[model samples]
Target: MAIPDGLDRIELTGLRGFGHHGVFDHERRDGQEFGVDVVLGLDLTAAGTTDDLAETVHYGELADSIHGVLVGPPVDLIETLALRMVDLCLTDARVQWASVTVHKPNAPITPTFTDVAVTIERSRR
Candidate 1:
């Protein structure tokens, strides 16, 4: 999604939440921790110049919203969860584009692995 140049970026990383999301039945029954990293593209000139809270997105509120989504519903795929988080970022008119990374650190793999994550990017069209 050709994001414009000079657009400032707001990054929120390592957001953790608990949810029941997986393909396996046992995974659904036993909840696990999920990590989210978000990058938002937006113009920060107004907020920078005016120093007004209303001029930019409130990160605290955004974090709460994302947390709610993480714990809200039981979705099987991390892809869907990532998309949901991207949607949340785009809710703000100021946000032009957003990228979300949903990390499933405790995925039910037979072999020991570090993590499994799904990332998605979306823009206002």
Candidate 2:
């Protein structure tokens, strides 16, 4: 789904972690670096007006939470990782929607490539 209109975004990009997530045995044995980007859509009116930390989602906590997921159980697909991130983002009641991207830079591909990524968008409905 598209991000709702009139919502402000808190973007956390290039959060890195190591994970044993891949289909190949070698990949599972030797963990690799992964990058995560999250765009959280929320109404920032309260925080903007009041200048209160409680009025907004704490990005540091969110980043740590996402990193926890990244370092947690092994998964076979980046798609699954992305979905888990979306779920995490939606846990915050203030978030109206979330766009998550999981980037696998060292994907097992024959041809040289810059990166491989999976993106998922989820909304609170």
Candidate 3:
């Protein structure tokens, strides 16, 4: 779905963590660095006016949450990892939508490739 109109954007980029997420056994056994980028759509008017941390998402905490998801468990696909991160973004009531990108720079491939990634978007129902 498209991002809702009038929603402010809070973006976090290059969030790096170590994870064991891949389709191969060696990938799961030997963890590699992963990167994540997130974009949150929400109304920040209250936070702007009130100057209160509670009125908006605490990005540090959000980072921690994302990091936990990245490092907590092994998954077969980056798509699943992206989905989990997006779910964390929607935990806050004010978030109208979230976009997540999961990056795997060390994917096991014969050809020389810079990176592989999966991205997903979700909105509140």
The best candidate in terms of lDDT: 2
Task: Summarize candidate 3's per-residue lDDT along 5-38 as a digit string, tens digits.
Answer: 8889999999999988899999899899999999
TM-score of 1: 0.94
Show where candidate 2 strays beyond 4 Å: none
Candidate 3 Cα errors over 4 Å, as ranges: none
TM-score of each: 0.94, 0.96, 0.95
Put the candidates in lDDT order, highest first.
2, 3, 1
lDDT of each: 0.90, 0.94, 0.93
In the range 5-115, model 2's lDDT, one tens digit per residue, is 999999999999999999999989999999999999999999999999999999999999999989889999999999999999998899999999999999999999999
**Whole-model lDDT, candidate 2?**
0.94
**lDDT score at residue 2, model 1, on the 0-100 scale:** 47
* Model 2, TM vs. native: 0.96
Choose the strongest candidate by TM-score: 2
Cα deviation at 38, candidate 2, in Å, is 0.2
Which pairs clash inside model 1? none
